[model samples]
Target chain A: MDTFAKLQILSGAARYDVSCASSGSKREAPSCGTGNTSSSGICHSWADDGRCISLLKILLSNDCIYDCAYCVNRSTNPMERASFTAREVIEITLDFYRRNYIEGLFLSSAVMQSPDYTMESMVRVAEALRTEEQFGGYIHLKIIPGCSSELVRKAGLYADRISVNIELPSQASLQRLAPQKHKNAILEPMALIGREISTSLVERKVSRRAPQFAPAGQSTQMIIGASPENDFQILRLSQGLYKKMNLKRVYYSAYVPVTADNRLPVLASPPLLREHRLYQADWLLRFYGFSAEEILSEDAPHLDESFDPKTAWALRHPEFFPVEINRADFATLLRVPGIGVLSAKRIIAARRFSLITYEGMKKIGVVLKRAKYFITCSGRSFEKPDQPPALIRQQLLLSENREALVSAPSKQLVLPGFFA
Target chain B: MNQYLYDGTADGLLSAIAWILEEEPDPEKVMLRERMDTLFEEGFTIGTDATLAESLFFRLKQFAPDAAHTLYSFMLAEKEGMETSLLHYVSLAFKHGDQVKGYLTHPAVRDIVYIAKKAGRELHRMKGLLRFEKLRDGAYLAKMAPDYNIIHPLADYFSRRLRAQHWFIYDVKRRTAVRWNNGSLQFGTIEQFTTPAFSEDEKKVQALWQAFFKTIAIPERKNPRLQKSNMPMKYWKYLVEKQGE
Candidate 1:
């Protein structure tokens, strides 16, 4: 295939992997390199799907040896297959980076030949980009499951971030949906990358010249709604991963059905609202100091459709509400529905000069519609989460942007990959 | 009533604010020269005095260092009442001294911060949105017409990132450009700017990028409203991906 046709197919095949962050690395251009990465990643473009395009995300090859039923590139699936030579990949990356089209390359592939062969192909591309071109931009490499530890370690040396998608939440689901992928095969590399990252950080502290191994750390993704895992199970697994594996991020890609498989559940569309809620709950876990259990119990395994996880929590725990905004600690302010990390900091700082009123909250960019119910400026409530909890739920539901999020009908899209 | 006018430059505005705060007795009585009848009020034309501007900025740094950046970014806003609003902000900064930034709720400080945020956001966006096409002469040329005067802020960033490559970032709206020659940077006006033929590979790669952009979006989750919010229509004029959209 020509470069244009190859790019369309490879990038289309890779669109389902939605880890677009090119952040957490501050690699500067070496001598006369083409590009560099910012600590806060830059989004070069927004796709029609509203997802940020930070890197030139593409699969190295769509030809696979494994038959994973959920994947577009399953071996049994009838599709036009193609692969880019290392030189072709390098040329495209350098050209794109030079034109300021992408921060770097996010290179992945289906199992081409075998795990080791696939990883070696990816490593060659990254190694060439770093050594030959002296390119210092962000590079995220996906480690093929069952790859040797030596190749896994080599990948960490060149990649800013490395990942091995768990693909399914549980071992039972993995066995049923993806027969080739095993739980231990995925977690072993994840654990190896995590150790290498920590060791590299510690070594660099002793000597600035130590080799950086995935300085941005390791992250993984679990395809939600692909298997029968509930939010509670998925979130609990994420929390465990964050604690044990020292994972930086756990992306939850809403499973978009591509094939008619007896194992997979039929859905009208991707559960995007559920995916959005998972992201919101994920934020609560990562930043807002909420455990998975606190956000949702086994009984109430799903997030509320109307209210966000934060507001739902605020309503659940009314005692936490009516906290005085002026004196609320940083932790307290974080729990409030409308107050984010930035606005909470502003509230604290602004109060040191003068007491904040309800009007001042709006001026400081606080979303008062939700916050008014949960907070008070100075011992006086702006809008009370009054007697009946049901009434409060109704009011909160009315405040949300319903049309854009919930009710906006998903149109039938003519997919480019649908041609294959 | 007292009136003061400056050349609308950052330094000129700083000098005027310094003079008003230091020499003028009543800060509230001061108004812009073009904003009032100078025939009745005492009007002072504050020239672009670099010495006064530097001295005042030095003082502002001692009290609140970030306030200097806030003022500089807000000066690039070019809003209708930008000058008058900044005057109030400067007054608050001087009055509050070290504690100026903490008063986010104060009207004067709040308005200035909002303007500063907008300018800062534009500067960050322009850093990514600005596209460079390779020229036949082996130099890169990118053109932009940003909402704020962010061409100056971009100098240090691109200077280090694309240090080896000779490039020119042109601000077409302002009729000015920042030229980067290897490591050195030059900021000046080019009355009429034109580019010779682009390099042979530019069109091929542009086409490849446009294809990649379309192919990457998931068909199941197409949201043009969300796309427009992130990459606004205002920016679609120059983007290669949005050529046909």
Candidate 2:
């Protein structure tokens, strides 16, 4: 087949993997070579799915040996099978990078022949891009499970970021859905990559000339709604990954049912809203200093659908309301529903220069409609801050609807109480 | 109206600002000379003096280097009524020193910061949005008409990234282009340029990319609204993948 036809099949098959980040590596351009990596990654285009196309995310081949029930390219599935030659992969990467079509290449493959064979083929492409072409662009290699430690080590040397997908949340789900993939086959490589990454980071600190092994670190993804794992369990697993594995990011993909499997739960649509809420909660865990247990409890295992996790938390902890915007510390300010990492920092800095007011709150990027209900400026609350949490929740929900109505004014449907 | 007009360059804007501080305090209107005729009551088109502009910028830098950078970015914005905003922001920066940037409550500081950020983001976006097609001689040519004047920084960036290849980045709207021939850089206008013969592999690579672009989108989750919001319709004219769309 031609390269165009091959790319169409390979990229289409690779769309299930949702790891799209190309940031966190600032590889200096080789003296007379093409392309360079920026610390802040650039998106060449936005796929109609709204995901940023930072890298040429494609598989070297999609012909699988393992029969994972949830995957679209499981061995039993009747789909187009194609693989790019190592030379073809290199040429495509160089051409795309030169044209500024992608930040770099995100190369993955199924168990083509075996784990070692597939990984070696991928490493050849990466090593050639680095050695022959002097390509300094970002390369994110998806490590095949059950791959050798030696190949994993070699892959890290050329890749800026490496990910080993933990595909399912629990061992039980892995056993039931994917009997072929062992939990150890995935975790062992993750452990190895994590160790090498930290070792390289320490070495780089000692000497600038040290070869960086996965300078952007490692990340993993688990399919949400594929197995019976609740949001609490998913978040707990992510928190553990962050704390233990030293993972850069933990992606949560809302599982899209492709294969007709008896093991998988039937859904009308991918649980995208749940996926979005999980991302918000993940942000709270990583940036906002919230823990998994803090965000959710055993009783309340699911995130509240009406409001975001942050607002929901605020409503539950009613005593935390009327948080003095001017007097609150950075951490406290971040806990507020409307204030984000940026706005919280802004409020902190701006307050040092001048007293923050209700109007100034809006100016400094605070979403006052949500903030006004839960915060006080200069010991003065927006509405006394004595309203019940239920009332506050209703008011916040109303404001959000009003905003939704205003933004999509093209839609003739209007919500009542918008004027009030 | 008390009008202080100047040329539409950053230096000219600074010189007019200098005129405001020293000679013409509290000018009701500060704008480009091309627009001065419409509301000309009493106006002086301040001759853009590099030394005077430098000295004013020097003072602003000493007070707040970040504010100075923000002002430079704001000048790059070149929006209508931008001179007035620049004048107000500079006066505030001089009075409040580095604290002026964080003083988002003040409309003057807020407006300048917002415009500067907007202009700066365009420069960053164009770094990825730029598309290069290889010419027959192996030189790459990209054409863009960005919302802001970002070609200067965009060219400076690619000069390093593509230092091994000859390339020209043309700003179609501004009637200018930046050329880097393997190593050295050149800047001028290409008044009578046409689509030259492309290299043998250019069409093949573009088709492959367009094919990859189509296959990448998940059919189940097609949100054109979000895609358009990120990569606006205005930018799609030059994009190869958005060719058919």
Candidate 3:
């Protein structure tokens, strides 16, 4: 097939994979190589839903052997299937790279003939790019399940990063949803790659010429709201993946029901807001020093839809409230209801020179309306902490209502104070 | 009364403002002159002092480390009322001693901040969204003339990643280019440069990217308004990956 026809089929199939980020890999141009890899964040184009589309994201083929019910390109689906020759794919990638259209290639494939066959095609694409085209750009190859450990290792050598999609969170869900794919097939390859990356890093430390093995580390995606798996189970799986396998990211894709099967939820659209909340909660776990267990309990299997994960956490842990801004550490200050990373850093830097006053908190860019009840600056409380949580919530809600009213007809409300 | 050539550039204008303040000249009598002929009979021509300009730049940097970039970006934008606004803020800074954060909330400074922030956000968003297309001669070409001096900041990220490929990011507004070939980058002007043709294979790939971009849009969730909000129409001409005839 021509490149355009191939892209239509491959991109349509690959859209389901929510691991399009070209970050974490820091490959610079070799002295003799034709391309370079950026250490800073990759240039990302956003889809309508704000998802990053930085790489030339596409699958090698959509012709699958397995029939995963939730997938649009499943074996059962009546969709046009197209596969690119390794040469064709390499040409397209280099062409895109030369035009400044994409930072790199995110190549994946379905089980075209077999798992080995699919993985071999994917590997060939990377090898051709790296060796023949001398493409030094970022390459993220998807490791098909049940592929040999050696082929997986070869993939790591050529690609900057690699992933094996843990499509479902639990073994039971995998059995029900994707009967053809087994849990062991996916997890075993991930385990092998994890070991290979660790060993390669060790070898690199000892020897100069050790081959780089997925320097960006591996990431996996789990389709949320697909099975009976709760947030607790999802978080537990993520926590284990991070702890045991040392995965860089665990992407949670909200299930967008494609099939009319009674087995799946008949939702018209994906629960995008829920997925957004999960990402926010995930950020808290990774960066904000919050544990997965601390984020959600058995009873609270879902995040609060109205407030962000950090704010919700602060609201729940009221005992940790009124954290003295003057004395609180970076972590503690970061935990306060309305303070962001920038504000936290500013407060830390500014406090070294002078004792931060309540007025200084405003200058430091703290959203005081939300943070007022949760912090004290230089022993001054704008709003006493003794107020009931319900009252505070009501007051905050009222302010939001007033702000909404003022901002609704912005042109009509010409007064500057309306926006303020 | 002293009327000086403030060189029209940021440093020159700032130096003139400094000289007026230092010389204790009458505000009503003081007038800015670009040429010697513009000076009146009573006007004494004082040239822009490079040393004074450098000192003011240093002091501004020390006072507002982050604000310096914002100030420079605003100046480059050539926005109206910027000189008076900058003068007011600088005079305020003299009294308040780096309490300029308070002035940021003031209406005049707030307006400047708002413009700077808006321009900064747009530049940042474009950093990811800006798409380049391959030309006939193997050079990857993308054109952008951002409101801020974002080309330099974005060059490091692009050059490091696309080191193997020869590429150029042309700023249409400044008529300058940040070109990288064989892993080395340099800046140069490309005045009235013509658009280059793409190779046959490159043209085929551009067609593929356009097709992919079109097909990926979930029809049910197709919101042109939102798309325009993120990738504004103003940027469409230079974004080679964007669909066009």
Candidate 4:
């Protein structure tokens, strides 16, 4: 098949893996290269699905030996299959990079013949791009599970970021859906990559010219709603991965049903709301100084879909309310609803000169509607004094509906703030 | 009332600010603007003085380098009534010294920072949005009509990223282009130029990208509002993937 025909099938096959970030490592373009990686990945275009096309995220081939029930490109599925040669992949990437079509290439492949062989073909592309072509653009390679440690090390040396997908949350799910894959096969490579990353950091600190190893670090993805894993269990697993594995990001792909399988639960649509809530909880765990247990417990295994995770937490804990905007420290200010990391820092800095009032807080980037119940300005409460938490929650819910109605006409999907 | 008019450039504006600093012009009695016909009874037009502008630029840099850069970026934006905003911001910086950095609460400083951020955001977006097509002359050509004078600022970035290639970015709206060849960039107007015919291979590659873009969107997760928010409709005319679709 031609390269264009191959790209159509491979990119369609790779759409299920929704790790679209390209902004971890800042690799400067070498003298002979045609591209460079920036400190913050630029989203050149947004697909109709609202996902950023930062990298040319495509698989090398769609033919596979193992069948995973949730995946669209499983061996059992009847679909057009194609593969590109190593040189063909290199040429496509360089041509695309020169035209600014992508930041770099995201190369993944199926378990073709064997894990080692499939991984070797992917690495050959990266090696040629880095060594022969002197290409310094960002390349994210997916490490096939159970691949050799030697192959993983070489892949790390060439690629900016590497990811090993923990496809199923638990081992039972793995056994039920994908019996060929196991938990250890995935975790072992993750552990090896984590060790290599830390060691390389130390070496680079000692000598300015030490060779970097996967400078963008490693990330993993887990399919949500595929198994019976609750939000609590998922959060716990992600917390462990973040703490132990030192993963850069843990992407949660809402399980989109493709094939008819008895082991998988029947769903009319992908669990998008649940996936969004999980992302909020993940943000809380990563940035808002909230622990996994704090965000979700065994009893409350689900996130509140009516409101965001942070506001839900704020409603549950009333003792934390009425944080003085002027006197509160940075950490205390961060806990208030609608006060994000950036706005929290801005408040701390702006308050150094004068006391921050409720009006002043709005100008400092605080979302006043949600924060009104949780904060006080100059010892004066923005909301009525001594209000019941249940009443406040009811009021907030009502206001949320009204807010949604007001914003629905415009249908404004608030873009992520550019302050960062 | 006295009105001070000058050429609409960063250096010219800085020279006006320098004169204002020495004159202590009152906000209500004095007005500063770009060169335009005024109906006022008395007005003074300041000519570009290289020496005074250079001295003032160095003085502002010595006071706060970041503030100077922010002012430069703000000047790049193509907006009206920015002369007064720039005057207020620069005067605030001179008064507060380095404290102006955190004074986002100040109205004048906030206005200037917001305008500067708009320009910065556009520059960053063009890094990804700018597309080039191979021409018959073996030179790559990209076209854009940005809302800011970002070509000069963006030249440094493309020089480092694509140092070995010969490419030119034409600002269709401004009727000017910046060309880079042999590791050097030259800015000039291409008054009689026409869009070159793209090579067959370049056309094929463009079609492939558009096909990939169409196939990549998940039907279940279609959110045009969100997509439109990230990439506004105004930028779609020049995008290869969005063209003819």
Pick the lDDT winner: 2
By summed lDDT, the worst window of 10 consecutive residues in model 3 chain A runs over A411-420
lDDT of 4 by residue, B51-100 (tens): 78888768888998888878778878866777876777888778777667
Kindly list the per-residue Cα lDDT of model 1 for residues A13-71, writing each as its tens digit: 99999788888888888977777888888888889898788899999999999999899
For each candidate, the alpha-carbon lDDT, in order, equals: 0.84, 0.86, 0.73, 0.85
| iRMSD, model 4, in Å | 1.6
A1-420: candidate 3 lDDT, tens digit per residue? 667778888887788777766667666665555556655545545454434467888888888898887888788878788888887788777766656567789898889889998898889889888877777888899999998888999999999889999999999989988999999999999999999999999999999788999998898998988888877778878888988999988887778777667678777667766777777777677767888888899889888776667777776777887789889999998888778776887788667557888776775566787888788887787886567667777777787678878764111101010000
lDDT of 2 by residue, B7-78 (tens): 677788788787787764553344334235565445666788989999999988888898998987887777
* Predicted candidate 1 versus true structure: per-residue lDDT over B1-245, tens digit per residue: 66677776667777888888888777755775433434665666777788999998888877767887787778778665556667777877777765676687777787888888899998888877889899988898988889898888887788877867898898889998889995788999999776779999889999999999999999988898777877889998889888875
User: How big is the positional error of residue B118 in model 4, measured in Å on the Cα after superposition?
Assistant: 0.8
lDDT per residue for candidate 4 within A277-299, as digits (tens), equals 88878878888888999888889
Candidate 3 differs from the real structure by a C-alpha RMSD in angstroms, to one decimal, of: 6.4
Residue range A1-420, candidate 2, lDDT tens digits: 988889999999999888877888888899978888888778888887877788898999999999999999999999989999989999999899888999999999988989999999999999999999999999999999988999999999999999999999999999999999999999999999999998998999999999999988898988999999899999999999999998988887888999998989999988888888898898899889999999999999999876789999998998887799889999999999878888998998798688999888888777776778888899988885599998988887787788788785222111110010
Q: Which stretch of 10 consecutive residues in model 4 chain B shows the poorest summed lDDT?
A: B21-30
Cα displacement (angstroms), candidate 1, residue B184, comes to 1.2
Q: List DockQ, one per candidate, in order.
A: 0.70, 0.65, 0.31, 0.68
Fnat scores for every prediction:
0.79, 0.75, 0.42, 0.75
